[model samples]
Target: MPRRFWGIRRLLRMPVTEAGDQYSIWVGLIYIFNLIVGTGALTLPAAFARAGWGLSTISLVFLAFMSFMNATYVIETMACANAVYKWKRIQSIKRDSVQDHDDHESDEPSRPFNDMEEPLVCGASIPSRYYSLDRRVELGEMANLFLNKTGRTMFYCTLCVYLYGDLSIYSAAVAKSVMDVVCSTIPANMTNVTDWDALPCFNSSSADPEAYTRMGCYRVALVTFAAAIGPFVFFNVQKTKYLQLFTTGMRWLAFTIMISIAIHLLIGSGAQSRPPAFDITGTPTLFGACVYSFMCHHSLPGLISPIRGKSRLGLHIALDYALISVFYLLLAFTGAFAFAHLNDLYTLNFIPTDNDNLFVKIIEYFLTLFPVFTLSTSYPIIAITLRNNLQSLFLDMTRLESYNFFLRKLLFPVVAVAPPLIVTYFLEDIGILIEFTGSYAGTGIQYLIPTFLVLCARRYCTTLLGLGVVNQYKSPFSNIAWAVFVLLWSFICVVLVSVNIIQKKS
Candidate 1:
């Protein structure tokens, strides 16, 4: 009824969008939260244990900030890509850029809903001069727009590597979780279990881990993991609404149980308090693990695109990062103190003893099987997404539109799932797998690609927009200096990791 009250309400309400396009900001934030807390988190306690609490804390906080910066750059580039497309659309007098809200294709420019994404709408009549946002310009399309063939190839290769590593790790984690749960019981003391001791049958880590890989309960578990998940690859992997709901519930429950137990142990005699202030030798592995854990940059488009009102979008992302950083610190710190022998999988440390109360045993069983079910569901979703990415990498989408069934049905899916499955069949050790994946591919995807894309996007935007068209969704760190900073950091990380690997081999 009052104009002042109405103004305040508008500010508080989510930015207005078409009714069909609207989703609560909370909904989008939850999706991002889930993405942040995945299988990589299971390894953090071990990483912290190795690197020491102080080093791990500092590295994680700094890496989280870097990740947030690059994510903004990705979004800025999306807007830039859309701006370039819109500029071309006006020049050609081509397909009405505003006609179809959904078809913000790779080569095309589309308008942000209500121009809400623009930093400042000048009320200028010329369409190309105004700010724009395009949700459809995903990371792959951004590379294609800004990068040469060599760069695009490098990006996709690294992306595929990360995806393959993800699937391999997921498969191994699920099998390992299952094997650990079914094949052995926790001792009466609830002491932490070592990989050697947890092994149902195998022995000698110095021996080739795969020498008897086909024998015993791990083999059965691996087969079961494959049997249960492998078939989903051949079909379209649509997101299951209710299944996600169930998994979300399971995730929060598992998290609560874990941190609760960790804190419980820390408050009692179980806390060992043995971490060094810092461990320089372990920093390389810590670097890789931190990079791997903060990996939401590659998937930012899909997560940010669906939010109803993106008003103060940057704040939302910052808030997400803040919450994630705090949560990771809590888990890592509590875990570092709770178990004297922290294994790579934090859940392994929480196995219930024969003397524990019924409640604690239930918690232990839940923790043991947590990764089994979580990673199992996630494996197929990731495999199918990778299959689609692989197809896009090699084939033109226009050609695939009218193509025959053979390439679409048989070849793509097999090519996608086979490598990771094969890796899982042989490589059972997740620690090495995570390190290798995170060090090389993880750095490339998280840093190099985004940094290079934003630099190109900034240059291309100036040339295309003639320096007058403002982009409202520009990154706060939209400077060449910041880009160079990211590049230098990534380069140093690679050099260090390479040296570390060489020394180990020597």
Candidate 2:
């Protein structure tokens, strides 16, 4: 085995061999689907309404295409990292054991997910080294290996900031959703539900309607959200297969219900017959929203690495992304025409808190509070990710193991969870915050990092494995052209968003 094979393994502290566990293609796709289609989708209709149906659709489709392209790059980069191992052990290791392991995993049931474990070593003395489908390479590790300290620092900061924003958005959305539905009961008159910014309705009976405002309820929910989910940040969250399945099921049901209701409303008199054809002012927000909505970049490694079988892996990812694109298109478009004024969170459209129909009221409550069902399951996982990144940023890697475990763990969770909760208290609006978060940090992570990762990996492979070696896991857009374009696009979006923010303030 070549010394280069052990280079990334030592640097990232990852196992050089497989754990004999891999996810089926369907499971992989489902993970990708569930991650992308969350609170982000809830804002699509409003984005479409402002950006215009046509522009919003085009932007979303374009962004989805970009996201998919970047996903391939991430996949290719992971393979390249594994390729270092492959290159190191290529001379000494043989293929018989690897083939047998693949065959064994193929025969296993696909219903329940498999746990990641140490690589199963069998026949060969040096162990079979191959960059097969189930190889795991986390993004942070990739940044460290392929990038300079400066580059790695940039990545860590961008990722942590975006994730903090993400947690904040999730916290606020669930709290607000619960507050909206719980506070507003069946109003005496449902004929005139306006899109006015009203404070939380706090009056119990007819005594004092102005006693409590919506903001006040949101404050309470925000505190409760922190209390319930904030603690999960301190612990390590592994694959909760059942919890994920439960959340994924509820997500599909809620989304399907929203879409069904939207279509029905559009077909009826509730349709916005003359929504703008092209809303130029709305394009920036739409861009941010779409990027936010399509974001699975930070989590792509987790989704792709554990999947079994790599026969035409690129096509599988492409197909998965295409399906998601169509799904988002259908969802955003339906929501656009269904109502005259859509909430930034499209779920709000379905929650007719004061509707006359009993069935409608039931659904309103269901859709309104649906985030609690889904985001609650995800909050801890994301917070943990953010927490880990903060650890990476602050502590020296060499000294990490020697650091005080209690302080190291406790400090990050508090740093990660507390600030976001505090920020959300003052900055109550989810829409504006999501814009800055996605337009800046989201763009860099989803677009810029993948490009650089691939470039660096390519350079590393060419230097180590030589130009003659073929990287089987290479991206279709594996050229400098795509990478350059992504970099430019990311920079342009950031500038545009900044300018827009300034103008709005002025």
Candidate lDDT scores, in order, read 0.71, 0.71
- In model 1, the worst 10-residue window by lDDT is 1-10
RMSD of each: 8.8, 9.4
| TM-score of structure candidate 1 | 0.78
Give the per-residue lDDT of model 1 (tens digit) for 3-119: 212322233232323455545677667666666678778778888888888889999999999999988888888778766655554443323422332354344343433344332
In candidate 2, which residue ranges exceed 4 Å CA deviation? 1-22, 85-135, 184-201, 205-220, 226-238, 310-312, 391-415, 425-432
Q: Which ranges in model 1 have alpha carbons more than 4 Å from their true place?
A: 1-23, 86-134, 185-220, 223-238, 373-381, 398-414, 426-432, 499-506
Q: At residue 355, what lDDT does model 1 achieve?
A: 51
lDDT of 2 by residue, 154-236 (tens): 98888887888888888888887777776755345532324212433644554544447566677888899888767666765
